[model samples]
Target chain A: MMDLQVKLPGLNLKNPVMPASGCFGFGKEYSRFYDLSLLGAVMMKAATGTERLGNPTPRVAETSSGMLNAIGLQNPGVDKIIAEEVPFLAQYDTEIIANIAGSTIEEYKEVAKKFNDAPEVKAFELNISCPNVKEGGIQFGTDPDMAKEVTTIVKRASDKPVYVKLSPNVSNIVAMAKAVEEAGADGLTMINTLTGMQIHLPSRRPLIANKTGGLSGAAIKPIAIRMIYEVREQVNLPIIGMGGIETAEDVLEFLLAGANAVAVGTANFQNPLVMPEIINELPKTLEKYGFSSVHDAIGKAVFV
Target chain B: MRKVEMKLVYARQIAEDTIEMKLEDNYITQIAEPGQFIYIALPNFTLRRPISIADVDREQKQLTILFKIFGRGTASFAAYEPGMIVDCIGPNGNGFPFDTDKMEKVLLIGGGIGVPPLYYLGKKLKSKGIEVTSILGYQTAAQVFYEEEFNQLGETIVVTDDGSYGEKGYVTDIITDSFNFDLYYSCGPTGMLRALTSKLQDKKGYISLEERMGCGVGACAACVVSTKNEQGYLKICHDGPVFPAKEVIL
Candidate 1:
């Protein structure tokens, strides 16, 4: 038997395969496909200070191997998520990773503090890199000092382990990762969607409603692995790596590239059972490297 | 509810850039309703295209879909042949509710790609001995299809934006003061649906809608439409690809 357990700062995951925020809703929609507890965790949608309907029609555009989305973070707000979505998720024995997004620093602090007493909420994945939004998203993620400030504020308000989600849009990833770690982030999630756009041929207009969207799916896997490799070398915090991770082999590659865990993003839209399928197939994939435990794969691709 | 791989029995282009394909599947044939649609998973495409179920042959255990060449997804589907297996997850979405007794004198209206699902509804109503008046609209004579199939069910009227064939006008042009209908069911573009729902105000009916969908099971919230409530949004795929005209904002 292989040991698939992963220990983050305060949470112990049964496996490393959890759906990324936005792709997996409050777990109610996916609960129909399989047992919700089958996942190591469930990253809820990016909740805001208030309810938002997001951008208008045509929020999605299909790309080569992935898709682009400018959903603009449409959520029911932090209070509703805690009062309603949290109680429903309590039935499932899974880690509830609250992905909080805000337009201001005070909004971020308020959202983080709302989960300070909730039992269903186990951790916070600060989504500072959501490329689809207009404010307090990629803006906070692109700048190191701003990233540090938001991370410091959220970490101060919450009792749970706060994992700062990093964006791949910037030039210096190591500097950003280091700054977040210095700001007291318990861990890091590498490679949020890269900014991209598409145009309609005949009409010659932007395809998505927001004109630009976040790129995610199998097309961005290589970039995610490279960023995870770079950040693991500089920061000592636990990392949750993601981007275009579709199969079990991709998860192992990210694990060996130095991610303590991995999150399946756009793949879930294609197959809702992807997380369970990957979790079930992880052992068979790990045996190829003769590793009896999951810890053996962490940072194995990087030479000491 | 289950992901089934169905063998394509036949795929033929019935009209200009319009292809209708039939697949052998029992689960969908048994549970699929008039407005319910299926999500077809293409090999290279990341997202599945949601096509409405045109007709179902329960005895033969088959499902048919009529799709236009809107993008690369449908264009690829046009190239498919018999014996090829297609991954389909469906009999999905809340289809049109056909339980109302007020539908004795039913007016069925559809435009463009939206015309197919109404064929199934027309046949279902006819089976219950209900009188159905189907109004199908298209851009031109060459674009109109399923005329004879809809005609077989009841009194079918074909209209076009341009007078290439049949009546010359939009589907909404058919709704006049003297033409009293107890109920109506429509499917079309947002503009057409908006016109139909508004012009036929105070009349109880349902309208089938379309949106850019993500996870067709209501998870992604990508295909949400504005609802007349505090929640504000309802999923087009789950809450309904089919909704009552009075309930939806559009």
Candidate 2:
């Protein structure tokens, strides 16, 4: 049997595939389609200090091979998430990685601190790279200093491991990676959606309500692979790579590009069963490429 | 919702820019409610198009989706022929509530392509022996469909903007106090819904909304609508494609 298991910081994943944060809500929606335990971990939606209603309607626009979204981090507050969502997720055997976000550093720390009491949360994915929100999301992501500062604060407040998500919209991605690593981050999730927009020809205006949205789908895979390869070369931290993953072959590509585990984002919208289908196909894919296990494929394409 | 490779049994244009597609081996039809929708994944498109289920013949194991070509994704449906497999996922979102025990006289209002689901809804309500009065609005006579089918159920009135068919004005223009429908179910463009809600203030009714959607399963909050409650917002893809008129702000 091929060993699909992988370990990263506080997560001992049965497989390397998981639904990316924001794409997979709080796990209740997907649990109806398939078993949640089939996944390595469930990355819950980004939670803030207070409940946010998010942006207006017409938040999504379809492009060529991708779609743009400006959901603005609509979620129940961290307290409700801890009280309600966490317990529902606790019923499953999978590890829970809470994605914490806020508009201010204090809010970030406050959200992280609240999850400290919830034992179901195995790790925290510091969402400093969400492109949809106007405040606090990509602000800290693009700037090296703010990225490092927020990482330090969130890491200090949480007992569980913190994996800082990196934005692709930055000019110096290596600097951002190094900044978070220097701030004592446990790991990294590279390449959040690139800021983009679409125009309705008849209306003669931007299609999305926010005027801009994050671009995600098969279009962003090459960019994610490139970023993961670049960041893996500079930092010695485990990476959870994602951008536009949809297939098991895509999973193998990210694993070879230096991601310890991979997350499935926009693809879930296309096919709800995509994650498990990819998981089922992964062992054969790994075997077809002559890799004995998941860890064996990590960074194989990266030449020092 | 289970994903299945549904085989296209047939495809034909029901009206101008509108086509009716029938797919078989659809497990979704067995449990699909009238107002629920399905996501159809097309070639080269990043997102699936959420189409309302127009009707279902469970014994024959067939389901119908009637849509108008508004975008490239929907336009591609016309290219599909018999025996072709279409990837789909659904019976998604809540359908119009049809509790026959409480409802006696019901009004079904639909506009253009929005008129399809009401046919199935009308059939179900008619089966329960409830009186159904339908107000179907179309841009012109060329765009009208399912009028005869709705007529078989009960009284059905068709209205067009240009007076090309039936009555002369919008569906709201034909509505009067004489109908006295106990409840209403409507699916249409936003303007019609707004006008209907305003005309019938504090009346108990349900309206299905349309928006650009990501995941039809409610994971992605891409298709959210504002509400009058403290929860503030609800996802249109999951929480509803159908909602009680008074609960939503728009």
lDDT leader: 2
What fraction of correct interface contacts does each candidate retain?
Answer: 0.59, 0.92
- Measured against the true structure, the TM-scores of the candidates, in listed sequence, are 0.97, 0.98
lDDT of 2 by residue, B1-250 (tens): 7788888998999899999999887488799999998888998898999999999999988999999988888878888999999998888899998789998999999998889888889999999999999999999999989988888989889999999999999989988887788999999999999999988776799999999999888988999888988778888989999999999988
Question: Candidate 2 overall Cα lDDT vs. reference?
Answer: 0.91
DockQ for model 2 equals: 0.88
DockQ of each: 0.73, 0.88
Candidate 1 positional error at A53, Å: 1.6
Error of 1 at B132 (Å): 0.3
Q: State the interface C-alpha RMSD of candidate 2.
A: 0.8
**Candidate 1 residues A1-304, lDDT tens each?**
8899998886779998898999888989888888999988888989888898888768788899999888889998989899999998889888888998999999999999988778778899999999988877999999999999999999889899999999999999999999999999999998899899999999899988789988999899999999999999888999999999888999999999999999998888777778899999999999987788788899999475
Q: What is the lDDT of residue A41 in candidate 2?
A: 93
